[model samples]
Target chain A: MTQRPSDTQPQGEGNGSKVNRRGFLKTVAATAGVSCLPILQTDANAFSLDAFLQKHFYEMSKEELERVIERLENEYKKTYNKKEFRVGVDPPLAGVRFAYALNLAKCIGCRRCAKACVKENNQHRGSEERGDQIEYIRVLEMKKGSLDLEKSNHYYDHPVPDKDSYYMPVQCHHCNAAPCTKVCPVEATWQEADGIVVVDYNWCIGCRYCEAACPYWARRFNFSKPRIPDEEVNTNTHYLGNRPREKGVMEKCTFCIQRTRKGLNPACLEICPTGSRKFGNILDPQSEIRYIIENKRVFILKEELGTDPSFYYFFD
Target chain B: MGPALYFLVSAGLVFASGPGRGEVKTVERRSVLEDQHGYYPCSDCHADQETNPKPRFLQEEHDSPLEWEDEAGNTHLVEFGEKLAIGDLLGHGGQTGNRRRNLVKVGARLDVAQYMEEQGLSESDSVYVLTHGGANLWCLDCHNADDRDYLRKLNGEKLSFDDSEYLCGQCHGPIFIDWEHGVHGRTNGYWNRELDQKDVTRRLLCIQCHIPHAPRFRGVVPEAKPVPRLDPVSEPTAESHGHERHRGEYDRLGPHPWVETASTGHAEEPAHDGEKH
Candidate 1:
């Protein structure tokens, strides 16, 4: 094979054919400078299945997870020439803190937060009568007197208030005593060490038991194999978020744990033009979510139900 | 320079014959462009699509064509198809041929896995095996571009779809509709102004919607497709098919029953029950 400029070198486009497959492989190896493993397992140099089996987001040792992030950053640098792209293998902060506050006064029913949530959590896609793909947050418009969920249907043809109306967006509460997790037969759905509720798309049996068990009707089953045409499909997947799910398994709000744990604000918070939503580490007193819980009057839906949901609502 | 350069692009998708091989296989690739994105030759962007369609300077020279104006506006052409890449299209970046390539915009139909569940193909031995096997089917098969007449779409009356619209529409009609009508599609702008006119906003091309490096959504994480920035001025607009269709009311006046807060609270008030707007 002729000596050729590497793809990284940015030669004029036609000058690229000089490199062959073997040369390309060699270039990649030299660029990475990572040594090959001596054996499949047992050897100190080899990758062990143990690392894969126990690699939960919260359960990782600091050194181990940091190493993983380093490996990721290196790989990304090699691919896109971003010399310093670091990935988070574990949550930056900790404890089983529960905090979410929604200001009823601010929410306009634009559903931008819902769109952001669907993208952020990699929520499975579905269709609504609006003839648009939908998932997760369903912004319901309610009249002042009517508390009935059925009457407060979210479907809107025009913009804001038709008259004296208010919008309520609902999603998974990630309850501390989650009834859905308890009812899961295959153990596909479970609460994480950080108290975030999650459903493993690969493991879910799609039994819909979790859907039935939830009093809030939070869980939704995949009706069709999620046929997300490539663009809309979320690739930054967790076992719980974004990866395509099997049909029939129950799914609900994951509290945007994928984003929250990464020190990124929840998609809903970013997209809320009205700034109706707030998210932060519940354990930390400085977090807005915590401040709202302490300073303002807060209420959890069906607090008497004892599910101990992480979500809280505020009126003032 | 004429249509001779057309076949060169398709020829590149063909498997190469190394030193030991002789005859290049002659399976003409059908154009998926009209049925989908556009029947575009690869050389239009890539510098290497058809480097040598004919023998030039002792090597096989591809038939990539270049449009250059000579003295009296009479044009002279250069064809080097296989050797073409993205750079060659600097001035005439993409003026090769007439192949309307629209981004096949598809809205969330059934989550593929969800749809399979509705079909009862559980992860049992029989079902799982079929799924695994079915995944191997080449995307180009069902996404057949050969059918010239396959381009029929419900072009909603508003803004006529440009090349981007037609390309994605051929294989994905439903998504095309949503995109054109604002569900699957995207635009850029704030409270007001027309697009690409006074308050211009470029439409999210194919690349925008599907970011290759950071693909927002995809399954299995195969080599992700390149996505461009598709941040629209506003969300795709809703298709207003002259109603009296789904829920009657072509137009009317009353209290907007659509207002959730008003209707539900005052059940006694008939005016609140969507009888108004």
Candidate 2:
């Protein structure tokens, strides 16, 4: 570990110790007060100074990114005792903008999608210290006649699809005019070419600005170190999605970038029993999402805000 | 790739060892009792009986107990016992058994006149109607069934279980049209056809999701409510909705914390003081 610079310095080696030491101490105090480097350094991880100074995802050079990825992989192996954990930086797919449409009539509120998301994203399981598990998707049970966000009940434990109710699962909408990205002071988060808004976990300064800016309450802040069991950790993680996040960073859904970039379905879509959830490249006119958008009365959550969210919902 | 190639080579080696001698020498013949045989070339089983025998119902020795299904009473009930009298069998109103139960029995040959008289149905009206419950049409309506328990399609064409869609489409025209567009039933293949060829074979048939006898989807057990992130340090709330982990004061609906930071005069330093690991 690199020792943090302190106010004290050793006596000069070549004599005239008092004069030289006084000058050195004065200069150090002057720099410390103006720079705040000492205060920021204290916030850095004690184990590795290099990790603390690592650049954000976009700012890093190719070689630097590779170094970071290698370090992360090694760190995962040591922490989890699993040599097979792989962390890949998959580039965004070209000529493809992902979109999702969920049918309100077909969803039965089984929450199988939510369950699969927790497992796929490797979210923290509930512990004695943390009673609730972290789930990316929230299925809101709303009354049949209205679509009131405030009146919706996500904690409804009753036998679902309760004759008069309908379920709407909400997550990160990956808005085109994302307010979260605009509010991020450090440019730690940004929208990719494929319409996915991703976060550079390491670079996020725990500012929680993105959390406040998101209209759907999509972003989540890690107030404590995320504790995941060794067996439950999903090794097929991407640089932008489902990566092991540290305490104080913000994390939200990324449309399962690791799987989607490889032409695989998101875990939630694959697990849905009713086939209510639909996901596909929005660029392709023949895609199911496009068909639904054209044929069905598709609507976004807060259309008035003009966020241009990729996620859509329609009734039968 | 190497392992797959090796396995293919090994499989070829095993087959190349030659077929068993006995299997090759044996004569290939369809079984007499096979369902598709349907008493074909009848002499094998009925060699003694003359070609033109007395009417089926006139023969006393071939008499079988008629079983009535009490469709109105309880369709799920299964009752099998006692011979029904001719009068009782012909009586329409007093028949206590479900009409949908045993439309066609294994060994019993229904007398058309008696069935019509018992159910008060005329020759112009068919006994079997098609729906989710029992089809009004009997086994003989769609199948040429014999006493030996063999069945064949009425037109002598083979019926495919996989292509039952056409058979069901005979009556359900609108629903079948909806199914063709992947609207009604579960579709199990790639939704994006530009990437992968449209494989209709992988799509689920109407029968796969809905049983013909009972077309309703079975109720599934709801997954446990998401244990929201409760304040681990605080006491548990008795109210179900109250346990929601309070997202700090600066969430979606709340104002951005820049104002408070300016007021507190600690804008230079990020305020992450209370976070615990």
Candidate 3:
């Protein structure tokens, strides 16, 4: 990426030459150091000093937060050509801890839930030849009478609910002991009080450590800017959820933070035709998730690792 | 033209019809179904038919049938009528004792008329009839023949399109039971029905997804198909690994098949070969 002219200021010849010499040497040294590493550039070439020095989510003042939101809203409006686009930062609801469960027996492997997730979350739609887009949900088609993950196939194109097979859709477990957050060298990702693990796109350095840490492979790293058609852009966005991401950042499902915080169900939950997916406040004993956990023989993937995933899968 | 002159001209034209040509203006009666389903005039079938009060077949009478005998040695058969009312239709799950249960409500018909009047619409503008894969069945099989209303309950209750499960339950009792328990169809509301009623309106109806005539969930287009998993970075050396046939081998084993190979230290390649947009 080339440095923008806005990063420098005009100066007198004598002093400017001396400063230029020093900057040239500094650039040479920095370039040499970067060439040996695989670190990704987290920002676009346009260098805004204020954005570069923006504070973390917890450390931002009220005024600064407002300024950030306005800036992002303007940028998105210009980029998507949607003047009415809004970016919201709705805080998590009090006394709500979300948990998810999937009934394997009922899931027909239709993949409608996965399709709805992409649209609701504003995920990039990849082309037929190139599967560059990120999908938060993956419905794995497994042979019937088997609980093994290795035998599952996610790319099967045949009609679903095969006579001899079943399906299991998986996404971020949002585990209590989230290995993704722990492995983040920078505190760009963290679990909210409501148990949703969220990524701060601007703060993330795009190291991809979290991707490697997750056993379920839930985390998706943006190798390039995500492409969403202007008309297809989901205007409803959350700071920690479906807001458009930058060129390089790590993101994963946050249980539709933009919707759930407002007492709405996640897109996938609403799209399941078989009533297989269940989501609710785990703390509320009267919640459906609570009933499933208590009554159904529920289990989590990679349980031996003790990740304590909020997501559970049961055969019932 | 000036506004007054335009109004005068239009009003003069309206009054200019000569008394000698005193034919009254009449609307051209165009059947709304003509454009969509072709014209069908009632006269096509009713032409030259004599008005008879009794059904022809019934009036023929059964051979040697006992009749005109009452409890006091006199009996009679009630007369069958020629003109059929809307209530005469029977539907699925057998008969509701009263014929009125099968009848379309007069209010509903009037509502349609009112709507058409408001919108400047005309008669028989739509058809709800569907062909279920060329099955030879009449509309009266599952709906009232005259008004197309559905009857699944015997207590004279009519079901809306949203109440498809109950309507379908007429013949599919087991499937209806499964749907009631949230096992057969989609459920979107808050799992804890006892809690907030926020999700009540959002619950999806069965007809919203499945076509009632052909209740099958269609597969999504290829563009929306689930992508394959990213290929694992490493695999066990075919020579070094043994006992590959064991049922629970991968589960109980220490080293997983997808573990990073000792040679490659976290290779972070793009999952797909597609060029970045």
Going through the candidates in order, their DockQ values are 0.01, 0.15, 0.08
Ranking by DockQ: 2, 3, 1
The alpha-carbon lDDT assigned to residue A253 of candidate 3 equals 94
lDDT (Cα, tens digit) per residue for candidate 3, span A197-277: 999988999999999999998998776578888888898899899988887889899899988776667899887766788
Best by DockQ: 2
Query: Which whole-number lDDT from 0 to 100 does residue B149 have in model 2?
Result: 27
Q: lDDT by residue for model 2 over A1-316, one digit each (tens)? A: 6665653556465745656657878998998777755444633233455677888788899999988888888777777765576788889766678888888888988999888998898776655556546788888887789887776777777666677778899999999999999999999999999899999988899999999999998888777778788888899899899978887789999998888776666888878877788777766654556667877778899899999999999877
The C-alpha stretches of model 3 lying farther than 4 A from their native spots are A1-45, A127-130, B1-184, B188-200, B205-223, B226-277
Docking class of predicted structure 2: incorrect
Give the poorly placed runs of model 2, Cα more than 4 Å off.
A1-46, B1-159, B166-202, B230-277
Over 4 Å off, model 1: A1-92, A96-98, A127-134, B1-277
DockQ of candidate model 2:
0.15
**By DockQ, is 1 or 3 better?**
3
Q: Give every prediction's interface RMSD.
A: 22.4, 11.9, 19.2
- lDDT digits (tens) for residues B73-156 of candidate 1: 555432211222222222223532211110000102124344445555433212111111122222222222333223223342
TM-score of each: 0.40, 0.62, 0.57
Two-way DockQ contest, 2 vs 3, winner: 2
lDDT for each candidate structure: 0.48, 0.65, 0.63
